[model samples]
Target: MAIDQEILEVSSMFRLLMKKASQDWNRGACKMNLTFPQVQILYSLNNRGSLKVSELADALNLTSAAITGLTDKLCSLNYVERERATDDRRVVYVKITKEGIHAIDSVKEIYREMMEKMFNQLSKEDIQHLMRIFAQMLVNIDN
Candidate 1:
């Protein structure tokens, strides 16, 4: 196949896979009264400990306004808290609460189960290869 044709086919397959995965994830998130982005924010905060609003926005590739709105909602849910810097009141940090940590743990469990069901038919070697490919793709995208 031509290179262009190969690209088109691969991209189409990726899009379809992502669509299905997003739907499944959304369903799981709904069970916890969370949206996909809300769960993502929780996970990010869990992994990074705490971050400034701008940093979170950059990490998520979302606008500052969007991040603010999401953070507000998360705050209302008691999943996250905004703290001002003691020395620099101008800087605000977003940190996950104990409840948020618990939420993240719950979401991770759901994600693990979902992945197991999705990849049950794949051999171990195949899954490893897919992981490698995905890591490389992420590196390529970053570059």
Candidate 2:
């Protein structure tokens, strides 16, 4: 095959992989009864601990109104709580609840299972090589 043809095939395969990965993630999120943004909020808080609403919005790259809607739903689900800052009542902090932690664990388990199934055929070395290639691709894209 020509070099350009090989590159085209590689790019097509990358897109297919990304599409399937996204589908898998959506499926997992659905099983947890959470929308993608809601799950993202749980994941963010789980990883970053409690954060102000504005900080959460920045972390998720969402508008303040969008974050408020997500947080409202999460609060209704008993997955998170909001607290007013002691010195500044205007500042509200969002914190994950015990239920939220459980959801985060479930998400992690779901991802682990998805990864195990997806790469069951690959050896350790193969995985490392793919990671290196992906890192290089990221660098190339950044430049």
Candidate 3:
């Protein structure tokens, strides 16, 4: 194939892979009454303890407004709580509750299962090559 044709094919395959993976993740998350973004928030809080709304937005590559909305839903579900910083009352921090930790654990299981199903056929060498390719692509995109 021509270089242009090869690039187009790779792009198309990338999109398809992302779409299918997203669909599978969404389906699993839905079973737990959560969306992918919500799960991402919980996962972040679980790992990082607590963070400000703006910080969460930056970490998730979402807008502050978007993070607020997601946190609102998570708060309603009692998965997380919003509290004002003691010394800096003006600042609000989002913390994952015990329930949030439980939820994230479940989400992690779903993620693991999905990844296994998707990549189990790949050999270790193939996985390493994929990791390198993805790393290079990210570097290129950042540039």
How far is 137's C-alpha from truth in model 1 (Å)? 6.2
Task: Write out the backbone clash pairs for model 2.
Answer: none
Worst 10 residues of 1 by lDDT: 31-40
**Steric overlap count per candidate:** 0, 0, 0
Question: Global lDDT of each model?
Answer: 0.91, 0.93, 0.93
| Cα lDDT, model 3, residue 94 | 96
State the displacement of the C-alpha of residue 95, model 2, in Å, after optimal TM-score superposition: 0.4
Put down candidate 3 lDDT per residue, 8-115, tens digits, no spaces. Answer: 999999999999998999899987899888998998998888999889999999999999898899999999999998998878899999998988999899999999
Q: Which candidate number has the best TM-score?
A: 2
lDDT tens digits by residue: candidate 1, 39-122: 878989999999998898899999878888999989998999999999999888999999999999999998998898889999
Candidate 3: which pairs clash?
Answer: none
lDDT of 2: 0.93
TM match of model 2 to true structure: 0.93
Q: lDDT per residue, candidate 2, 8-39, as tens digits?
A: 99999999999999899889888988888898
Ranking by TM-score: 2, 3, 1
